[model samples]
Target: MTQKVLVTSIFLHAGGEVDHLLRAEGFEPTYAPALTKRTEDELIGLLDGVSGAIIANEPFTDRVLAAAPDLKVISRTGVGFDSIDVAAATQRGVVVCNTPNVNRYAVAEWTLAMMLGCARHAVKNWTEMNAGGFKRFEGTELYGKTLGLAGLGGIGKEVARRAHAFGMTLLAVEEYQDQAFAAQYGVTYVDLETALEQSDFLSLHLPLNAQTRHLINAERLARMKPSACLINTARGGVVDTVALAQALREGTIAAAALDVFEEEPLPADSHLHALENLLMSPHVGGVTTEARQMSGVRAAENLILALKGQAPASPVNPEVIPTARYAVSAT
Candidate 1:
């Protein structure tokens, strides 16, 4: 019996490369593009009899996992796996993997772009110019400004490199500090509070977890300088949306540019839409052409290896490998 694999991410099959890879591995491929709004019922229905899947930002709750007993592996096309319940997957002996390094530059570049855009009032200036009006908005220069990083992972490191090139001072807060890296990059290791209070621009690169969810709350936002700008390309739930909207509205912070939001599609009736100091993108921070292609290839490889009972390149839940019932035989 040929094992089946579901390809749920729209970008994974972009050039049909992932499908080709699945075929080469003797796995039947099913295409059910979720387009970033996958419901639990939809995922359950699509996952029936699927041994593996390439998912995007779909939520895989414990209930959803219970419905798909045949699912042995889940390979995410991007680094962020917050949408998937890893603990539930691990308990079920399902291997979870993600493509991480592929999108570091893409997300880092988007972060810097948003930072510069917010600093220079790029969107507002262009909008006013197009509306048959002349409004000269004086903008701040990025050079000589302090950039605070919430995490110093791959994406954060890339951002630091670019920020340094632009002559920006760096401050960072990371759970695992690399003293050598900080010294080489001239990044000052500081506490979260100090980073927020002293930064002219704060960029979030942390993951969304129990401890990190709503990490940037009202109290932390209050600690930031009124002239500071916040940039988030990491995860939406990392920052409290209500607190951020309130901050932007009351000038608690000067501005914010977000590539991710707590509620995706950012509800049409959301208060964030009315704020002029806020810049929003439809979460395309890591959607560059090169990044997408690389991630697609990596995700496919992960699924194929896991289904074959071989170890995946980057398993998010490696603890399950030892006890996984479907693990590939070591030949």
Candidate 2:
């Protein structure tokens, strides 16, 4: 008998490849219709006897999991698996996987672009210029600025490389020590306080876990130089959106560029929308054609390997495999 699979949170480009790949693995994959709160209901409807799911940013709460009792695996589209209740999935013996480092270059480039945007007040000047007013917008130069990176991982290293090439001083802080990596990148390892205080442009590239949720609160925001600009390309909750809005409104910092928000599809009433000095993107730092296809293909490869009872290259919750049985046909 052929196993059944469901794919949810429709990604336009990757949908075709995901369907084809699952079919090649001898599983019949039924894609849930376009993303919506009601899409959850659609997934439940299609998941009646489904064995696996290739999930995106849709909410996979305990209720959703309970509705699909036979679900054996969930392959997440990105590195962050916070959308799914991992504990509930573990209890149900569901294996969840994510593709990391696939979007490192794309996200890092976007982060640097945001930093440059903030420094030059690019959007503001462009808006003013188009309005037919010769606005004298004096922009800050990046050639001699200090760049602070919150987490010195793959994305952070790429940011450091680009920033260095632009003649900026790099300071990085990580939870665990890695002096060798810092030395190779010419990154000065510093404490969070010093990095936040000294940086002309502070960038964040960390996950949103318990320790990192709202890592940039009012207090941390207060530590930054008044002329400094803040950039966050990582998970949204990693920085407090409210505090960031307040900081931008009160001119606590010169400017800010946010790619992600604590809430997806940030509300129209959000204050950040009205702020002139704030630059916002709809969480598209890693949405380039190359990154999207790479992430999709990498995730597909991982799913195929996991189904074949082979170790996945990027298993987010490897422990779940202990309780779950690998798909039989994959072998």
On TM-score, the leading prediction is 1
For each candidate, what TM-score against the reference? 0.97, 0.93
| Model 2 per-residue lDDT tens digits across residues 112-222 | 889888888788788888999888778989998999999988889899989989999999988775788778767898999999999999999898889999999999999
Q: For model 1, how many clashes?
A: 1
Consecutive 10-residue window with the lowest summed lDDT within model 2 = 6-15
Best by lDDT: 1
User: What is candidate 1's lDDT per residue for 291-315, written digit by digit as tens?
Assistant: 9999999998988888877789999
Instruction: Name model 2 segments beyond 4 Å from true.
Output: 12-15, 33-43
TM-score of 2: 0.93
